[model samples]
Target: KKKKKKPRGSGGGDPGCPRVSKPSDDLQTSRKSGFFSALPLRASLRGYGFCMAALFLFCFGSLFYQLNGGAPQILQDIRHYLGKKFSLPRALPFPSQVVYNRVGKCGSRTVVILLRLLAEKHQFNLVSSDIHNKTRLTKHEQVDLMKNISKIPQPFLYTRHVHFLNFTRFRINQPVYINIIRDPINRFLSNYFFRRFGDWRGEQNHLIRTPGMKDDERYLDINVCILENYPECSNPRVFYIIPYFCGQHPQCREPGVWALERAKQNVLENYLLVGILEELEDVLLMLERLLPHYFSGVLDIYKSPEYKKVGNLTGTVRKHTPTLEALQVLYHRMRYEYDFYNFIRDQFHLTKKKIGLKSASQPPAYSSAFLRELTLRTPKPLDEDEELESDLEDKWLLWCPS
Candidate 1:
């Protein structure tokens, strides 16, 4: 080519240079390689961020649950599940705040477990049953306690063996109240046995132990303690269940129609339900039918103690019918308790009739129908249908008549 001498100097190009057939392709390949080289760094950084976020969440959740005195095992899992899939309806017909004034020896163990289960399912904070502090609290201390209770997070489920008080003193938001009642005789027997034997589940109930009945010598002769007016059992009036449903007033402890009337009035007006231990299945089924969001098969709480392992549920033993003397004294002393129990029991039967339950053995009609519907609609293995899940929730949410 006459040696590159004939190259025209149109620009800075060297005419002797050979033109590459695919320069653009080579450049693209180099750019792609550079991007691939950076991929690992980007991935590691994202992973690190995710870990840090999860760690922060775990710590915060633990502290919140501890301070609230909670179902520690449950809240964490629920918090995580709710973070990604919060399904609580935005337009609920009622306030989500729940106050379970848990009464002792009233199947409260199973009730608490059921409550914790519901709390987890519904993504709510479940406060521990920490009302052991209720006894002997001064007015100042009571005020402080109420104030502290008010400060806890909202949409909270507070469970306490604490008696109902005029919470208006604390000026806190009113919550939906729920409680359970047991036959006064049975409750007294359970309390006596639980205190004497700790827990039937082979666990000690340190919080509920009698004060002077600590040592083995004292525990051996618990009868003496009772005869000597021990706070646990000396009181013949198993006034235990009375204070729970009524406000703080002298009449609450009185054994008369006034007390029963007041307690029953509170039951009919304030409480969502006052479940009976004898009819626990009906109670749980009724709860599921009325407040499905707060209950997911609570009967499982009783049927399986390890359902969540939060409660001390165990098998039943035949209750020893106290001698006629004991029953006579108990009836005379705890006359109000008997009346209240009778009132509630009568209402229970009336309610059963209203809900079409001719016998105590009958399951709630709504829940019976719902279970059949659910079984029919449940998806088979290897089948994924989101609409079906939504429909299930909708079915459970069928408008419950007040």
Candidate 2:
């Protein structure tokens, strides 16, 4: 046989391809040279087993991420590098508990009727309180009412003609709040007439509703009440809409910036969707979008002929528009109410836009003078140095980098 060139270096079998080392060969080399070399092959294999287990865990961990609706790490890394925020996709849970602390004469009766149908069809507990007259509860009453509401079964929607109750203040689990509001002047006019001559039902309904009212009180003229500044038509009473949102605080009843700001803040923090009565259809649409479980088929039910016939019965009879002069006085009285209503309306429109819904009525654009006046009314912040010094306990810095 031709003298076989002694297989090159330590490969010992072939010179043709220059021995291609396998991962097994590398492992063998590592095991033989390192601290492991002194141990048995079985001991070296134990380390190999640990490495294999780690790789297995890493693969399953990636699979687990994908199962819970997360993107792969490589794609997330690419998004990060591209300066895009990566949001992990997750299923949105339906809000089971909801509270519609209905404002008086804001078309809440119409909504409640629709809700009755919804509750039946959708099979959710609809605990609508029968107590319509009592809104502002005493401290003991608030605690009692909240306790009763808490005891109701889960996946329920509770509605009532009550002012906002701060569940958090009482340490109860706060429910998701939803409400409908109307133009301040329009709401006032509706209530003004409704108290005197009920709806399509009859005057008897008004009599039953306000049993203690005097005949003089029942037939009070809208123009006279507004122009003459009657208690029912003046400051605190005309300041109706704010307290419904601003909670049961005594200050909420007083017409001021504090109540207005507090109501606006509560709308942002507590209330889910505050719909306007003029845009009731859009309100239902938003409710369906926001709380699909409770309000899924609400819009369809509202549009039905059967529902329309029932809704017609609730319309305020002898509803008359106030004269321009009387309306001007009423508007001035409800300036703060108008401010809150405008804020809620704008927020509703913005949400509608976000969900690809078009509004038939757009909010009016303000003039430069009006905007300047609003800017002047806004609270001004102190300068940075002044703000820093005002709250600081120490005048001197503890440490500086440079």
Candidate 3:
């Protein structure tokens, strides 16, 4: 058959020879190859879509974060991460030294109670002085006291009924200072009643505390005390709150513009915070925020059932609200105090706002004429002479043990 054509896979070729594919087989092979080849492209397309979606979400999230003022926080966190990752490590000083030259009758005892629990839990030193009688000290005494305070181990909180002690003035490292104050009239009233009847400690406790008190003096009507201008209810006594901030200057004990201004300046410069006792919860919240080392969880402690029971047990024995006329007189007498109180309240609200807490209202911005108005309100012509400390009983000397 001459060189007749043989089948590709069979014939006179070697038995091991490979077969050549037919057109139909080629078509099937091409289809399989095409299907396998399309898999990679399809996978790549899915990956690309996924990346695009992720990018879109990232961009949207960034925009939303920026709108919510979270961009700076993100940037800060990134910077912090980078700094920690790449920078040479350096020890940062923790704020460990704190001073609470606590004002008397300003819920300090309650704070102390909470502090006692916190100190036990947090393992920090809490030095609460038992001495309540002396707030002012001689230069020598101040130096001695500052030395003593500085010698306390680090991470310590020293609290006492004392005026502001300028450690820097004596070349000692100044500790962070915090304080709480009450409405001046309210403070006066509290002190006034506390001296006479004591707290829930019982009347016998009061008798032992004030052995020299005459029945008339002890039972004196509060209205008479304010209206009749009793020495205890007047100037230097009402002048009380400012001196706790105004330092140990003898003049600080007097109620005058100088003392008031000095107290304000000191508060601005030295105090980390000057809270109002009326907003005690807010005060504690701020404390927790500003001094987490010492005051963390303090609010919870204050709200605990055990703490509430203690508070009730230690409440003022007899609190009398003065007659409206007496209250008005007391208010006028405490005008400077009211001014300081208003300032502290405004500052407190501003701080609250900064910390993302709601305030009933923002304080009005003071105008340039504030000084003139302040002077007019003081009315120096009406200011009487503040009596000597010895002339009146010092009700601030009262301290109920916790």
Candidate 4:
């Protein structure tokens, strides 16, 4: 053994040599084994990163799709794949051909009735807002509604309580634009009574006590006061009248002046049609002429006894003297709207004599019985069956792949 040890030093006794010791052989084996062991972990980590990146890409794509009203199949596939990967309700399509600017208490309900009749009579593809009780929606809500409308396939009609200027950018060709206006003074008063008394049942005596409250707060009960006094508020944009009486956004710099100019321009530029609430019968006549196939002989203007005494204040004390000051304020505020309305009235040949009624005529023909009939016929709690069957059919056709 001593002779072998001496020989080992000269040949390969160096501690650093791999063959010199058993420990060195064990170290090399451990490193080689560990290298293969870590291979699966490294591959798994790469796969996890790839999966994360793919998931991120999918989420980003979905967000963009949702913002643009989603893909056409989104609504169609909702029933099939709702509980799986994508679980959101589909957005309903809105008609874009017909635009209805519903001015409150201006016989808008009658206009809605006529639109429904037109839809039924012509069998034209149409869509009406789901507004059952509320008169107006917030501006942002209206904008969102319009965005949803923009996604619909064209060649369709829609009715809603929207401002005329709100839909100017829709780029629809030869779209029918219709609205109703009323005598400003009478309109204001009617709005007041409805808000204060909750119908014609409220006492007329409350007019004087109304001034004590701020203009905005005073008309809480009256829808008209809210519309008229909206301009005076710090945020005039909140009012429903802002789009119609004020003008389009960004162009509404000077509320009083710009609104008037814009209103005038809108009336001139578009295929705008006006209906005087006071001359609703004549309005029906004009509509019959314009949409002959759909509306001919459809308007049943049944005169009501209640409307006969609408403007008769003989027995009631004259509490609000002329209400001229208030009227003038509103007229000046909405000068452009008033002027444009007057011009439209003249153009349509809707004078007092032509309509066969004084400014003091009874409530619109459909104010009583027609409304009652409509209320009974339409679905109560509007949302229950607001699913328009025709609209759905049209949407299905639009969504069909080419």
What TM-score does structure 4 among the candidates reach? 0.45
Ranking the candidates on TM-score from highest down gives 3, 2, 1, 4
Pairs in steric clash, model 1: none
Tens-digit lDDT track of model 1 for 192-305: 665555654644553345555556543444344333334444342346677677666656654456666777787887777777778877787666545545664566655784
Question: Candidate 3 on 230-281: residue-level lDDT in tens?
Answer: 8877766677788889999988887778988999999899888899887888
User: Model-by-model lDDT, in order?
Assistant: 0.59, 0.76, 0.77, 0.49
Clashing pairs in 3: none
Cα RMSD, each candidate:
20.6, 17.1, 12.7, 22.7
Residue pairs in steric clash, candidate 2?
none
Model 2 whole-model lDDT (C-alpha atoms): 0.76
lDDT of 4 by residue, 1-402 (tens): 465443344355674554445788889999999999999999999999999999999999876654333344445355446645576643333223555656766777555555554555444455666543333344655465666665544534565554554554554234567677776545555554443443332464455434355555654433333334443211232222434533435455334556566665676666446767766776766655454433444444223434334423212222232233333344444434444555656755644445343444445322335334433443311111121212211121111111
At residue 80, what lDDT does model 4 achieve? Answer: 41
Model 4 CA lDDT for position 353: 49
Looking at model 4, the pairs that clash are 195-221, 195-222, 260-336
* Clash count in backbone of candidate 1: 0
Candidate 1 segments whose C-alpha is farther than 4 A from its true place = 1-93, 133-147, 168-171, 203-211, 214-237, 254-257, 300-319, 357-402
